[model samples]
Target: MEQLLDYINQHSSSGISEKDFETVKSYFTHKKLRKKQYFLQEGDICRHFGFILKGSMRQYTVDDKGAEHVIQLAIENWWVGDRESYTMSTPSVYNIEAWEDTELLMISRQDVLELFQRCPAFIETVKMMDDRNNIANQRRITSSISASADKRYTDFINCYPNLLERFPQHIIASYLGITKDTLSRIKRQLLQKE
Candidate 1:
């Protein structure tokens, strides 16, 4: 809980009061996931939004052809969930899986609603986060549509150097909307250029 508070303090300048933190903490349940475990599966409602205390997670969707499409990755100090399903209480389209042994502080939609009603500052922080996430998604979509595979791979590597090291190339390829074979070819080209 203290660690969560510290993380909030670092990421948000709005300042969560100790009392508010305690109130927020009351709403959260700590959870652990073994590597490869799922936090949420497609066809199930995503009841909680999780804040990662340790380790990494991936959010992905399986296509009709049974291919998994990577949507996002969250590491320590990040948040992961199917926001639409969590907020609307609908079945999720994505699967949220642990990429490593993970610890999360999770809050339900009801708790989040209560927090928003009780804490204007926290609400503001949440709004900021949402805005940033939307912008990022938009940027990724634009890049995918406008950029070449090599350029996209370069942009991804530049943007998330840590993910390049931590995630498998195939998953990264999926996230970039490219095939694994294409990613391998690009990687080889990049290496030759280097």
Candidate 2:
């Protein structure tokens, strides 16, 4: 909770005073998920957004052919939930699953709205997060459509070096929209070049 408050304060345009920050912190509740647990599944209505405090989670969609497409990988201090579903009150297409034993600070949509109404700093933090998310999504889209496999892999490393150690190769490949074999070949080719 302190981590989340600190994160909000850091990202916010203004600092939250200790008493106010405590009030802001009160809006969240703690939750945990074991490895392989589902925070959300396809066709479910997403009710709460969570801030990861510890461990990792993967957000993905399963195709009709039973293939999973990794969309987002979230770890500590990151936020998770199907935003569209949570905001619009619709069923989600993605599954948010715990990749490891995970702890989170969960907040309801109503609480978020209340925060936005009550705290200018919280609004700023949300805006900053939205801007960052947009930039990342745009880069991912451009790389997915135009970049070579090697280039994509390199970009993935540059963007999320920490993830390479945390997630499996196959999972990373899925996130990069590449096959496991292609990722292997790229890694091998790069290794040989080095």
Model 2 spans with C-alpha error above 4 angstroms = none
- TM-score each candidate: 0.93, 0.98
lDDT of each: 0.89, 0.92
For residues 1-194, could you state the per-residue lDDT of candidate 1 as single tens digits? Answer: 77778766665677788888777788889999999999999999999999999899999999889999999988887789998998788999999999999999998888888988887656766777788899989989899999999999998888888888779989999999999999999999989998
Q: Lowest summed-lDDT stretch of 10 residues in model 1? A: 6-15
User: What's model 2's TM-score?
Assistant: 0.98
Check candidate 2 and list the clashing pairs.
none
Q: Write candidate 2's Cα lDDT for 36-135 as tens digits.
A: 9999999999999999999999999999999999999999989999999999999999999999999999989999999888888888888898899999
Runs in model 1 with CA error above 4 Å? none
Output the number of the TM-score-best candidate: 2
- Report the error of model 2 at residue 177, Å: 0.6
